[model samples]
Target: MALALSLKVAGLAAAATTILGVAVGFLLARASFPGRNVLDTLLTLPMVLPPTVLGYYLLVLLGRRSALGTWLLEEFGINLIFTWQGAVIAASVVAFPLVFKPARAAFESVDGQLEQAARVLGTSNTAVFFRVTLPLAWRGILAGVLLSFARALGEFGATLMVAGSIPGKTQTLSIAVYEAVQAGQDDVANTLVYIISAVCVAVLLTAGHLAPGRIARR
Candidate 1:
């Protein structure tokens, strides 16, 4: 059950990350504006910041006392604190940078000349991006998606902070292993650890297969 929940949350987070990451990444790769560098730095901050610090920021931003949180509660009665939804948000926040960086790199690698030619031929920017740029960069974007999913699956500190490891509610695989170890259940911890390791390895292998050229370049 914990494993299932973990996958569920991670999957949802990864999907959300992919949508937002792809947009932000493409913008970063192709567009330039006054605050582009600042936006890029802000987007990538989670990668370098400590997880606990990130969690704390999320808590402050989404907790009931904050304006958005208060509006959510009053308008929709949707509470993010200690909910599975909150877990998804926390995981997404931390995993976003992982997805963004590779996706941005992939977008940047695509031949700008091709896009320009397509535009000259009367293809709309949206059509050109979807039919040209995205298809060309899909391999690296897929790798980023896989990496984001793996990162989301393994998220611990932020999840614990926002979701509280509630049994059968937000107790993800990582939290389960943590609680198991705290209770001296070595066998349980080991089993969960092994499962997580296997999942991570599989994701990495698939990602590598998808972007062998990128891997080789790195």
Candidate 2:
């Protein structure tokens, strides 16, 4: 049950982060607003920062002390610290860069002419995008999203720091494995390690197959 809950939280976190990654990737690739470079750096920050540091920042952002965090509690009654949902947020932030990089690359590969042709054929820009562009670049976006999902699944430091090692709740497979190793339970940790490895291999292989040119050309 504990393992199942961790998987569930990981899945939820991965999905949330992947959604954020898609929008960020699209904006970074197609738009050049002010402070674009800064935004890009911030988005990529988690990749470099220690997971504990990322968790700390998230705690500040979502804790009762922060103004933004307080407003969330006052207006929406949503407390984000030290909760299962907070685990999701922490995992998502850490995995965000994985999703963004691939999706942006995929979006960049799409030929502008195809979208233009759709527009010329009386399709609106939004329609052309969903009908044409997305179909062409779906593989890359999917690869990115899958990578993010896998990263979220294995997130340990941030998840543990922000969410704590609460069994049947915030504890994820990575956290469980960490605890097992710390307590000298090598066998349990080894089994969890094997599972993580299997999951990573399957996701990465699928991502490889979904990469550009893997699918038959239209």
Report the number of the highest-TM-score candidate.
Answer: 1
- Cα lDDT listed for each candidate: 0.95, 0.84
> Which ranges of candidate 2 are over 4 A from the true structure?
213-218
What candidate 1 gets wrong by more than 4 Å, as runs, is 212-218
* Model 2: ten consecutive residues of lowest lDDT: 1-10
Q: lDDT tens digits, residues 50-135, model 2?
A: 99999888888888999989999999999877788988889889988988887788778889888888898899978976898788
Total clashes, candidate 2?
A: 0
| Model 1 pairs in collision | none
Expressed as tens digits, the lDDT of each residue in 100-125 for candidate 1 is: 99899999999999999999999999
Please give the distance, in angstroms, between residue 51's alpha carbon in candidate 1 and its true position after superposition: 0.9
Worst ten in a row by lDDT for model 1: 209-218
